[model samples]
Target: MFDTMTMTKVVGGLCGTFLVFLLGGWAGDIIYAGGGGHGDHAQAYVIEVASADDAGEVVEEVDFSEIMATASAADGEGLWRNCRSCHSLEPGVNSTGPSLYGIVGRTVGSEDGFNYSGALVAVADVWDADHLNGFLENPKGYAPGTAMGYNGMRKIEDRANLIAYLDSLDD
Candidate 1:
């Protein structure tokens, strides 16, 4: 059903297409391969990022003791909105995370009927103020391999307040 002319045209079309692709590739290499007179020399642009010390200075270090001293349970209750999705405030009711009811002074990994990662059990004995502060600052860092997916409360004030709110629940 096909003629020689048709075969020749088909071959020519494919060859043309391949030639166009090769030319395009060569053009791209010339443009992006630093062929614009910047051959093997140092980079023209330097990106300056703020040092860790500078970043640390930018964020005022919060004293958890001072914050907890005046921490309002009311403010903490509001901040609890972030934790509410993953945790429940009610005793014995575990959500995505274990219940935070009486968590302030409770032993870590001691929640009945809730499975806990061995990391938590190994690192912490009780959820004291200091331990809670550190854990709240960075859950994954405090207890590596912890199943808690929380990125952690960055602000010490917020953590203190949340702890206060949780502490208030049991009383």
Candidate 2:
């Protein structure tokens, strides 16, 4: 039968467990307290980085063609994994985007059955390395109204490598 003593013991056990947790948290807070207001605590250690202005290093503009010439198709093949979801490497096969098999020199927005947005055609006539570079660098930026929602590959090396790989597929 449910008795007053049995209920009191059960309640006491719960209160004891709660007290243990409360005391433990209070102790931990005291032990780990930083003792400073917002943004006032000293950094554990400072990492010194050189400022571009202070370094006075001249950054020469890199030629895109030169970068493209050195691109490795093999490296680009690895990067293609990212594009695999939307585009097909096989000619005549279209996915969310058009096939990229002959993209290197193919006319923009000319993929047979794929409904390309007018954005790509408006930006460039052909998918040459240069145009591909700009497009790969920023898809939405290059073609403002294109359906290619990919944010873009940011690095020039990556864009060059991907183009080289696509070019190699058709050759």
lDDT of each: 0.88, 0.88
* Each prediction's RMSD to truth: 4.0, 6.2
Candidate 1 residue 8 C-alpha distance from true site, Å: 1.6
- Please write out the lDDT profile of model 1 over residues 1-171, one tens digit for every residue: 689999999999999999999999988888899765667888789999988677754556766788889988899999999899988988999988899999988998999889888899887789888898898889899999998888999778888888888989996
Residue-level error in angstroms, candidate 2, position 112: 0.5
Candidate 1 global CA lDDT score: 0.88
Per model, state how many residue pairs clash: 0, 0
Q: TM-score of each candidate?
A: 0.70, 0.66
- Candidate 2 on 49-126: residue-level lDDT in tens? 988778877778899999999999999999999999988888899999888888888988898999977877789888
